[model samples]
Target chain A: MRKWSWMTILVAVMLLVSACGSNSSGSQHNKQQSNGGNSGSEAEKQDVTLSFIHWRGEDVEVLDGIIAKFEQEYPYIHVETQVFPSDQYQSTAQAKIADGSVGDVFTVFPGAQFQAIARAGLFTDLTGESFVEHFEPNLIAAGQQDGKQFALPYQLVYNIPIYNVALFEQHQVEVPLDWDSFLAALEVFKQAGLTPIAFPGADIGPGQLMNSMVMNNAPDEDIFVKLEAGEAKLTDEWWVKTLAQFKELNDKGYLQKDAVGAKQDSSIALFVQEQAAILGTGSFHLASNKASNPNLKQGLLAPITVSADEAVYEGIHTTTFMLAVNSKSKHTEEAKLFIEFLSRSDIAAEYANGTGQNVTVKDVEYTSEELQIVSEWTTKHTRFQPRFTISNGEVQKAVTNSIQAVLSGVSAEQAAAEAQAIVEQQIGQ
Target chain B: MKKHLRLLPFILPGLVLYAVLFMYPTISALYYSFTNWDGLSPSYQYVGLQNYVKVSEDIIFRKSLGNNVKFMLTVVLIQTVVSLLLALQIYKKSKLNVFLRALYFLPTILSSVSVGFIWTFIYDSNLGALNKLLQIIGLESLAQNWLGNPGIAIFSIAAVQAWAHIGQMAVLFVAGLQSIPAEIKEAAILDGASQTGLFFRITWPLLAPAAAIVVSYTTIQSFKAFDLVFTMTGGGPNYATEILSTYIYSSAFLNYAFGKAATASVYFLLLIAVITFLQFKLLRTDRVSY
Candidate 1:
């Protein structure tokens, strides 16, 4: 009984010590702030730190600059940025948000993920915010749930096929304007012992490729919207044909035969090294490629169409990353201030220049040549292109898997049927 | 009442932490499993058994369940047998044996994500060490896409899981072997027992407790497989390597079906519980009072 009493006393003392330790540290922080307050004029108040979480490790330096500028402008508000690896970010962010420990502002995708969180009122609805007025209407709609805007886009990503200019010139391969011409050019590249396109079969590469193909060939704009609404099915002829086209490239050996095992970075490396003629990637990669190999010339072609009959749908233009203020955050006002500061055209231009991407602000100019080309492509082919919306993620996964299945000796019909079943099951649930 | 009060103070912090961190979540998961909660929604309908029914008919979930069972069985058998064999070989305290033991255990200390990346590079068709080694040995035809083939991807991943963990099991077995009284082995040897006979009759029986630990630990770890599968294939090459954890993750985070994910977790918990219980029963050994 004496030993038990001593143990209980020790535990209580340890707990008290820890509690005191925390209290002192917190008071120390307060003391430093108060000292600053004492030194500064009456106008300067205590510091308010807002936590901003995002997944872009590459953009850390750029974000730091932006944060520094924002801090200078709003002296009392400081933004502490937290970043996670892209692959783990979604799950980590979701877990944090679910646990009610999300940062003041965090990056969110525009589709199902954004919608799921937005619908649950996790994000403070920015529907009436003045900063929301600066973004494109289509982009605002992309991040909308019902009638309320919950996300604010900062950058635009254009998903055109970036190509090696030297390789295409070396092979005398003309840029293919239609599906048959694309195949012909690919066959030419294959004959020259070059990989036509370095497709990463192991990741979202297949899905992106299929989306580009389907969008290029799509007869109407509402395919994805219909699928999301359950008014359509994955077994639709267009989707099957899209997978078949992807498989046809695999069959023809234009896609690296071993691509099914190769990752996105590895496949992109092939293109960057000029081992492949074309790379189906976004315009965002141009600056990085130039930095890595300055001598290697790169260019973009309009996304391929299905023969001469269908109009080319250019490429999927969507928000690169969007910011959403956590509804549960204690510092919502500061978060809003930071978001609005980012929406300024000068800051948007600086970000675009730093990141080598296009911004969503109305007056922000395309800072890079790559952005200009993307702008040209989208401008020329606006009529046929679908408005930027998040595709049904389940359907997208099904199509990607179907492409892999076709390459793995499953018949196109069988693969399509299996994918259809999976999508239908997803819809049914 | 005083006796209970004294004990309660000693355990209070741990009990509070456990209740807050573990018990609360587990109980909440149980409650959420019966609802139509999307993990984010403030409002959810009570849809009892619907998520489970959906899971029962979900082909991908069924496939994932089968794959997980295969993963668990393969990992348990391969890890246990391989570890036992290696432990026997290196149980002695020679410098070489200690070095080999440490060398084998090196992988166990590496994060699963790092191991997955290392193995992924090793299995790469064009640049991988495995394929290059085959090329060097004039067995070029034998070099196949180890991770790309749907038929073998899961097994390949399982093999990696075993490789990464078998070392820890071997170390555990070694500890078990060392704990066995030296006199027992000497007595068997003095009786003119064959080495194999002594091992089977004496050494093996004594190693049961350790074997039970290894088998049980590996079994649970295998069922909870996530990082390796997530990094290696993301349960890809056409859902060939989909396991319950990855499926549940996709359902919850990717597909936004949190109710289904919660139900899957409950099922997973029950499965692991039953399997571990069965393993404990089957591997139960008489206490050696040496």
Candidate 2:
């Protein structure tokens, strides 16, 4: 009986130790709350591991260069990179943010989703940082909401109409500047037995291109601001006129025959294959187009000349990608340092020239003539529309889907009506 | 009492784990479902029945629930019938039968994520193998966007689900088929019955237990269909292929509406429970004496 009691005590002690071990570790972790930039007293040169997440398959080498420089400068911190596929990026990032397990820094598109994240205080405020000062005002404006800065422009992209110069030269046609001339150019290409404009009407990106055209041609940016504030409806005369314009493009034979079945990449490939004479894409396509057809002559960036007056064309700045630090990060200072390093003019130049990205930094030197032209155009005349900055993901998706429906035979009026209803539902009006 | 006390030490760990990991979280989730929480804010309000009210009016939620029910019914009925038929044909002990059974079960081993992607490529409108084959066979007019057309996308996704799980069901049915004594089959053969009659009368009657298991499993899985719909249609072309799991995911992650997502999950749990209960009740069989 005494031996039995001794055995029981031994088992009890073992169990208690195990339970206490697990509970203590969990409590210790839970005790370390995410209070931004509050550095606890630890070894000054303590070994720290930081995780950075982004989606950049084409510019991975440039990213590696930036990471190397950061590590060389901050020897105490080791950075690990996790690249998620583009399709799953938004949901995956959201999941990480919800679970309080987001990486120190992550990539975010400049729009309503980013705004919501910033509004919820999910990203560190980078307003006073030197890197924020270095960015162009429009680029900085894209990442700002409620007068607070939450992200920095690490890479910049501008949506422009890129035509196959070789095809244009072959057909003896000049690129069109205004909507009327653009339609006429399409007629010329169609007569020559070539697809005039490859529109990925089936996908959301093509619909976005249509939206961009409408936004660019708006009387002023105030219309978009009004729309965001619920003071204006898409069913108004301006939107009706815009829908008419899109319908006009569709009626003309300039658009691809099966635009509803085309994808953005496939549409771009059509231009590369010389099947289509024109493709509208961001400046990121330079590397891909060159790779697809090495001997293809470079195309011109036909500014979306919506109005005869150059004033309307001069002030349209589309949204670009931005880098945001997770507000819940324990290492906010280190994350800020990384963002600052990447935003430096010299570093931006290295990234831009090496990866063929048209960056937004004023001091970055462009190696390619195409990038140089886009940068110059952006600097000379561009304004970030507030529509792109509203924090409403559902509304954006609804508008995108409406575009797809319209391109697939749903009347533009019907699509606009449905899109207006969805926006109203989202804002609970 | 002392002997039982010794067992307490052995059982204590598992009991604690279950209470902490399973019971606590489930109960908490149920409680949270009645609140209005945006997941990140430090505070939330207890708005009883408001989330449920919103769910009732939500068009996507209703559509997804309907799709889940449709999937459950089709997968449960068709998969059981097809798998049982295949099992009956290959019940004999032949090398070819074994090889074919193994070949049929290959899809069950691949991950559902990979299978979803493979089927997406197969259903691609422009560059898919299916469309290309249709064109080759002069059936070009029949080629449609299988995953994009809202009318047929759900059924197309259901067909893939059936293909992926039919093999496992077949193996289960085979085991049930073999468990029946050979003398029963022999008696049916001598009763002047045709092969088809023999199966419908004797073999299928004996396979009720296996059918119950397969129906229950497949119904649960179909209700939880997420990856395939997520990868293929993304519940798109106007929410045609949406399911409860994806709806819950979008609500929780995209909208950050945690309380609503938790409410959606409770609905899912209730759905699975009711379906399982009905299946067991409807398919209940009395033991047969030889």
Candidate 3:
């Protein structure tokens, strides 16, 4: 009987330990909360591990350089980093957040993804930090909620098409500043046996193209954002016109044949091989395109949908790749320190030059030829890429799908009606 | 009793792992299905069948479900016929057959992601080998955007899905073909049964177990394949390729509606279950013996 009782006791003890082990994250969260009270040299004496997670595998090399510098400066704090593929990162990061195993710092997209995570109280408040003020105020708006800065937008991009200047010059075609010339240029390129604008109707290309498509058509800037607020409808003239442009482009055979099936990489390849006159992806892809074809000459182009005189905006520009510290992170202080370190003008310049991305850090030198080419457009009147304004991914998907349907031979009005139906459903919900 | 007690430690580890790893999460997912959980937050509003009702009414869900059925039918019908044909040609033992078997089975060994990328390049309208081959043969008029066209995109991917696993299914059929005793085949030949008659009466009926396995497996794999669709198209050209698995992923991760995703998942599981069960019943799981 005693032997049996001893065995039962051992089993019970093991079960309890396993159960307790499962609750380690909860205890860790408590420890993080407790650690918030300590500061200065006392905190520095103990080594703290800060996990930084992001979805940009392309920028890993540049990020590693930044991380290495930060570690060198702040030896007491060791930063661990992980980069998830863009497609799978969101769900995986959400799972990590739920389990309290997410990084102390993480990168989030500007609008819908950030809003979703922020609503769940995932981001540490950065409003009090002085570094928040150093970033251009407008660029940082994506990360602010309820008058508080929840994150900092890092990447400044032209979210429009990047044209091959050499192709245009070789064809004796000047840059088209308005709708008529844009179409004319496309015809010229078509006659020259080149794909006019390499439109990726599939994947994220359609959504990103929305910024430039509606840039000059809208009554004001941030029209897509206003559409989400019920101030505008998808059936409105501007949106219908946007859809028509896609249709007209497709009908004229300016966008590559079977553009609807083309993904981002294929479209970029078309542009790189000089078979396509323009790549619809802009500054985000400049470095990669330059790498793929070193001799390739690229220039930014966002067509004024209206006549040049009527156009209010030169192009679309937006800050993306918002960085935030986890609210529940055990190493929040150290994570914030790393973020602050990255925000320094010199550090941001190093990042921008190395990655061929323009950061929101105040007044950084542009040494990369691609950056120098796009530098002037940064000073021009450009609207924030309006696609990021819709905080609902489904509604956003519908909006892009409408454009794709038009590209695939649907009438603009019909596409708008279908999209409007979805927008109405979203509003009702 | 002492011996059984000694074995408890080994069993306990596996039992605990199964409970914690599999059972706990599955049960938690079920719980989340009934509530409006966004997957990020711990607390959620329990809305009973509200998530279910919403999913049924969603246009995207209906479209995706329709796509899923079309994809499943394509994959199953094509994969079944091709694999069985391959198995019949090579079921007999030979050195050449051994080499041919591996050649046929080559695709199944590669990861779906790699296969998807390879196929994507092959299907490219301009630079892709498929289109170039068509043009080379002066069949340029027949060349189409394999993935870009909304109408045929799903089928294009389904063909690849079938291609990926046709070898695997062929191997299953090969095993089933090899299992039948040679004496039975010899007896049938002596009975003056026509080749066609022998196939329908003996070979096919005897091959039921393997056909059942192939059909059921193909159906399941077709319905659940995510990486292939994601890598090739990411359910695009305007949701034309959006099947249930991709739809569920978009719902949870893209839409940030985990409750709706979970609700969709329940229906998705039921759909695959009902399909496979119907297949099993049609094939009659009771083996036809020699």
Q: Best candidate, TM-score-wise?
A: 3
In order, what DockQ does each candidate have? 0.33, 0.27, 0.47
Identify the leading candidate in terms of lDDT: 3
DockQ of 1: 0.33
Q: What ranges in model 1 sit over 4 Å off?
A: A1-48, A94-102, A302-305, A329-334, A382-395, B1-17, B190-192, B286-290
| lDDT, candidates in the order shown | 0.78, 0.72, 0.84
Residue A63's lDDT within candidate 1 is: 80
- Displacement of residue A130 (Cα, Å) in model 3 is 1.5
How accurate locally is residue A180 in candidate 3, as Cα lDDT from 0 to 100? 97
How far residue B84's Cα lies from its native spot in candidate 2, in Å, is 3.2
Candidate 1: lDDT of A275? 86
Best-to-worst order by DockQ is: 3, 1, 2
**Each candidate: fraction of true contacts kept?**
0.50, 0.10, 0.51
lDDT score of residue A100 within candidate 1: 33
